[model samples]
Target chain A: MTVMSRNDLLLFLGFTVVVLAMPIWLHPFGAAYPDLLQRFMIYGIFAVGFNILFGLTGYLSFGHAAFFGVGSYAAVWSFKLLSLDAIPAMIFAIVISGLFALIIGYVSLRRSGIYFSILTLAFAQMSYNLAYSVLTPITNGETGLQLTLNDPRYLDRAMFEAAPGQPVPTLLGQSLGGFAGFYFCAGFLILAFFIAQRITSSPFGMMLKGIKSNQTRMNYTGFNTKPYTLAAFVISGMYAGLAGALLAVTDPLAGAERMQWTASGEVVLMTILGGAGTLVGPVIGAWLIKYFENIFSAINENILHRFFDFLPDGVDNVLVAISSKFVGEGWFLTLGLVFVLIVVFLPGGIMEGVRRIAHLFDRSRRSPTKPGKATPHPQPAE
Target chain B: MFEVIFLQFLNGLDKGAAYALIALGLTLVFGTLGVVNFAHGALFMLGAFCAVMFRQLLTLETVTLDPEKLSPWGAPLEIREPLVQAWFGDFGAVLVNYSVPASIIITIPIMLLVGIALERGIIKHFYKRPHAEQILVTFGLAIVAQEVIKSFFGPNPIPQPMPTDLRGAADIGAFLGMQANVITYPIWRLIYFLFSFVIIGGVFAFLQFTTFGMVVRAGMADRETVGLLGINIDRRFTIMFGLAAVVAGLAGVMYTPLLPPNYHIGMDFLVLSFVVVVVGGMGSLPGAVAAGFLLGILQSFASMTQVKALIPGIDQIIIYLVAVVILLVLPRGLFGRRGVMEA
Candidate 1:
């Protein structure tokens, strides 16, 4: 493992504080609710993991949701068989998802670009279909894999006597829910982010970037690019798995829908819409998308009426009617529009927009001091 | 057993026709424009909705007072009659009954316009971007298109019944000089298969016989060389994109009778069609067609009782399994060109 620099360490600590305090910060927005907050952290971790492979390596895996789903399944099984403690479940998830990613990445890495994407897609779909149908005994099919009261839970039994009511996943004996769940997810997200940051700044990260820039050139120079990409793929898969495990830890249900192509597409959208290859971009993208999904989908005509209540009656009605098409059931439309606009206008995504705004401010501040300096500085001093 | 096999084979052919049509269009776009269009399936769904919209248009109604019939709480009863029937009488009734087929005429023009608009408005800008970017933008477009349809038509599948004349089953056993009803299939399915063949054949013939198509084919092989030869290849490529969209749309329109038109129908077929395209070999027209049918038949066979019994969940993942194996062994698909999208 590479040691973090002072600046990197500070940045990691700052990120940790922000993530841990998200509930407090988001309380005003009314989005600090446990379920949504946990989701933000979990998906943030997923996007960060996805960025590891897609951002650095430029290999787009369209089937990452399989790993996520597999992780969830593994975690649920651990809960059912071993213990309600999230540690073992999460470890099982990471290991299983890593193994699955190794197998898939080994096969998919044979081809690059779109072919690789299609291959991963095929594999993911196969897993999804199997989970939905043939593996119904394990997955429990359409109803999903849920914790049954009769589950053996050997470790839980050995460690402590069973409590009354339905069993929930926990850290030691403290049940994971509400703020505790969010914090748990935040801890994992921070760990995942720190690992991702190290990977981005490491020598291995440079090699991956080289492969992304020109794999052919790297190959000609006697570098075995395969293992590097596969490593990235596996690492990212493990990240996705960890996120999935967290999901199961927070809420003990594992649905096959998580492995669907649409779910995979959602991650891709997050990575791109937040700016691929950027450290913070994917996490921000995940947060924005999850926020939109939770918030926009909940907005109704009634809410719209309240929002525009102070306007004239006819005007209010018309505004509410028009806005109604972009929220609630129309949230997907809004998402699609945002996706298209981002890809079309700002291919670098929100991170790029942020960078551009920062650039403008930097230039505005420096122009007053150095009026005659015509040459734009390519690299700004950190 | 023979009868079962024969029936499954027929079923496979019908399914294959759909896969082949969609994949064929996909191959055309990839070959000509060098862009992997994720929204091609959306075009297919839009085509199906066109049929739905046409049916709605033909069945537009008007109310009139019928003085002879009085409602319990009203002075006179209002009878609703189709505006088409009121205008064209018997011909209008016939038109309404055959709306699925009649929609074909309108669907072609509308789909063509849609194809042109999509190519011009969005895809034209993305021709130079990376495949990933193309995929993202087009996937976004697909979602938007699907959602728009959902908002308009709701999420339910709208059943578009076949014409009354084509409602019954066709006895393949009788046609094959065997006992009747042993090997039977729906009349509409046969029509769909035949229609796919005609359309596929027409597309092939158009490419092989026409001068414009020759230039497009040349462009596909070497874009720069074609451009250097003073031929306006971009315009031809745009037209090809529209043609491909029309092909996908027409496939969807005709498919309404087989599977009801739904907003998510395109997405359901999208992944399968992409699999078909890859298994057929990227940028290979014949490969796409062949793979489409082969996978379709293979899927049907996998779903057989004996097959499923032998390999519990084989039916669900047969296509993907085959794709994985073929991709591993062949890499370029069955007919994929060397170095095409190898980067």
Candidate 2:
């Protein structure tokens, strides 16, 4: 077995420290609250997994939310049937989501580009429609899949007695909620990040990137690219499923809305906005978007008024009126504008913006005689 | 059972008309510029709002004091009258009554302008980018457009009723020499279907017979070659985009009376229409129209009580299911050309 490199070890340790300290670092933004923090970690895992396919292989599966939703459903079902322990539920979620992804990925990988995207979208929408309507016996329809008091818990009945209040999912006997839930999600997120890092740096990752660049060229070279792309798709799908299961672990219910195209779009946006090919970029992007969703939407007219109170009366009123449109109910408008601006100006997303700033500072500090060598960054899939 | 099936078939035609119109515009943009316009549905929503705007404009009120009448609070009562009705009397009343149909006249020019402005302003910049970027930017634009409409009209569906003359159902059975009440269809829906045919036919005829459309078709086939012939193909492409937008707008304008227009109506139709476009074969006009109606009929049939009894919720996903099956069997779709968007 090859020994771990010093850089990889450092990166892993740094990632672990940063994620574990999220509650502290996020304190200033007021998004450090447990529920929101857990969401950030979960979605980060989702975006990172999504990057494995979209960033590396250039296959955009618009139906990943199906896997995510399926995972959630599976986790909830596991809890209903088994003990309240999250270990079984999480395993069930990942395995089921993987199976679903394998089937979907196998079929969808037949086409390339927009056709592939549309096919996945169609399948996901089918799943969502069925889950919402005819699959109500399992999914419980619009109200979502929730644990019932009389659920046949073959494992739980033998291990534990019924509690007075609704039971929450636990790790061993420790309930997965509050800070405990955040840490649990954070732990999985770290593991997911490590797995994604290994995939991105491996020979398989290079093969996927080759496919992204030119599949015809790869095929001409006698390389069967289909299995490589399919493998990437399934791996990413499992990542989505893991994230979905984590969502259920933190909160014990699953809604069909999780499988909607918009949710799928959200992960796509996260991956792109962070920087698709780069490892840390998606996690950053996920945190940024989730932070905005939580913080921006919470800013009502009163909050705006409070911020604008120091301004002159007329100026404050005008500013408040203008700023109000980009917050509260208008957060989506802001989100849309952000998406357009990011795609237009910073095609490489926030990471590119950071790189440019760093380059500027680096150039200013270094000798003027040396022209900075341009690094060849991989262009995002066409 | 026969009557039920026949009614659904008619219902399917009406639904098919909408799908056909939207997909037609989508194909036009894709075929010409090679850019996917996700905002096409928003243009349809905007067209619906044009009718709503016209109604609001015609019903603009003026307050006049009535000296003969007094309020219960002892203030002189003011009467509110629509300015158009006061000015043109019966003609104005008829205009207001038929505002939805009347809006088509205004909708065309406005939608054309909207289309041209969008192409010139935003879409033109994206022509050279990747399809993914095009999709992302356009998706963002669609959201913005929908939100703008939502801010103005709120999130609720705005019910636009048909003209009183067009409100009643037509007796199809009587016309067919069957029982009088055996099969009936709504008057507006029939009008809508015929209107869609005219629009579809008109678009095809324009493409087939007009010099401008001929140039555009040639350009679609070989853009660089056509450009070498000294034609201003770029400008023509812009105009084509506008034309496509107008087509979509007209579809929406007429559809207001059928399904009440909501801000998210564009999004609701966006996915379905894209499926229709893909099913018909991207960049194929006749394919889009044929697939639209075919899927529409299939969807309506799936919704049949007997069919639903056999397979519940099939109607909701029939289009998607068919799309998946078709794509798996035929990757380029039923009529899609090989090598087009394959990469």
TM per prediction: 0.97, 0.96
DockQ of 2: 0.79
Assign candidate 2 its CAPRI class. medium
Q: TM-score per model for chain B alone?
A: 0.97, 0.97
lDDT of 2 by residue, B23-128 (tens): 9999999999999988999999999999988888998999999988999998899999999999999999999999999999999999999999999988999989
Off by over 4 Å in 2: A1-6, A369-382, B63-78
Tell me the tens digit of each residue's lDDT in model 2 across A1-382.
Answer: 3456798778888999999999998898788899999999999999999999999988877888999999999999999998788999988998999899999889889888888889899999999999999999999999999987888878988977877678789998898889999999999999999988888778888999999889999999999999999889888989999999999999989999999998988998898899888888999999999999888989998999999999999999999998988888888888888888898889898999999999988866663445344324533568
Model 2 chain A: weakest 10-residue lDDT segment is A370-379
Candidate 2 second chain TM: 0.97
Evaluate all candidate structures by whole-model CA lDDT and list the values in order: 0.93, 0.91
Docking class of 1: high
> Which lDDT tens digits does candidate 1 get at residues B1-343?
7889889999899899999999999999999999899999999999999999999999999989999999998789999999999999999999999999889898888888888898999989998999999999999999999999998899999999789999999998999999888988999999999999999999999999999889999999999999999999999999999999899999999999999989999999999999999998999999999999999999999999999999999989999999889988988899999988654
Interface RMSD of each: 0.9, 1.0
